[model samples]
Target: MLTGIVEIVPGVSLLKGRLSSHETTQMLQAEGLAESDLIPGKYEGILLLKAGAEVHFQDYNQEVLRALTAPNVAANTAASGQHAEGCTLRRPRYFAGDWTGLPCLLEKEGLLATYDVILSAETVYNLDSQRHLLKCIKQGLRPKVGQAWIAAKSYYFGVGGGTASFIQLVDRDGTFEVKAVDVIDDGASNKREILLLSFKA
Candidate 1:
């Protein structure tokens, strides 16, 4: 989700543009991320968060977090006659780091292989990073009961990574069962799919 300031405004388009002038892009270029959105072992397409600067996806992230933490907020409000604001909630922990090594680090911190459900969106656009991403999921996701939901296009035209390719990888790995939970074929964009990966029984 390469969001921008406009994302904070209501009714704004969620379409993303190239990061031509963003400071993060410049910094990545300086660090040798020439033109590609991703460069393995060097830069992955994450924006650097600056102190005192509002993150582009902050609002969306907060909304999602709140929904996850208080899914019954509306029901509670109607039943108890209390407003949503009165409900006390504990926030989930947020972590940011390179995807390549994050799983190993979290494992050392006793956080790996603990998640029941993992979600990833639009991450399979680059062929180079898919293996690393899969590795991270394999390491962090709980065995047997854990599952990962990946949303990606059926075919990424230029970068050569997509749901089909990813499923092939998973099949070759032989550790997970891949299933297409949903498919989106709007005719305006590339065919997209939501894939579910779970450990083999």
Candidate 2:
């Protein structure tokens, strides 16, 4: 779970551009307890990790950026003083140098062997990768009881993808049951939400 958070933050930084790494750390530090509220109460699972992963973009890839911000996530986790262990970052399981080709490459090393719960934040903005993301969920998530928690703005203005559109894809396939778990109105341009997904019963 921590690793997933680590993987996600850097991509977000690339998107915002204006927030420095230090500022990002400060924001996480400031949030403190508010951030804890986002975690599930009964989570005892490892997040599927793909180390050395890059966010492929039309212009430039953010592999180096993701690598650099990963350490900060560990620093923040250490600061939070959680007693969790077994967080190891590994090179992505790449097949023919493509991230989307396959995931969980570290499985050969026996890491993140099970993913009962998957969490992603701000990852639905890219329409191009949504299919791959969904494929990851379908392949990695534990059947029946496994769940996915996706957090994003209700609508992303320029990117043309958001929770609504992602949910539309899920609805079109009927593979999972999804619901809006929480909505936070931070007085921002768009409302933030957490959507919970589970395999259909």
Leading candidate by TM-score: 1
Candidate 2 global lDDT? 0.54
**What TM-score number comes out for model 2?**
0.55
Off by over 4 Å in 1: 1-88
> What CA RMSD would candidate 2 show?
12.0
Weakest lDDT window of 10 consecutive positions for candidate 1? 43-52
Question: lDDT of model 2 at residue 22?
Answer: 83
Write candidate 2's Cα lDDT for 48-85 as tens digits: 33222221111012222233334333343332223224
Please list all clashing residue pairs in model 1, or write none if there are none.
Answer: none
> In candidate 1, residue 90 scores what lDDT?
26
Error of 2 at 177 (Å): 0.2
Predictions: Cα RMSD each: 10.1, 12.0
Candidate 1's TM-score reads 0.61
Give a tens-digit lDDT track for model 1, residues 1-201.
233322322222123323444744554555323443442222111111111111121111222323221232222223332323333322334444447867766778797888777778888877777888889889888888989999999998888999999999999989899999999999998899999999999
Q: What's the TM-score of each model vs. the native?
A: 0.61, 0.55
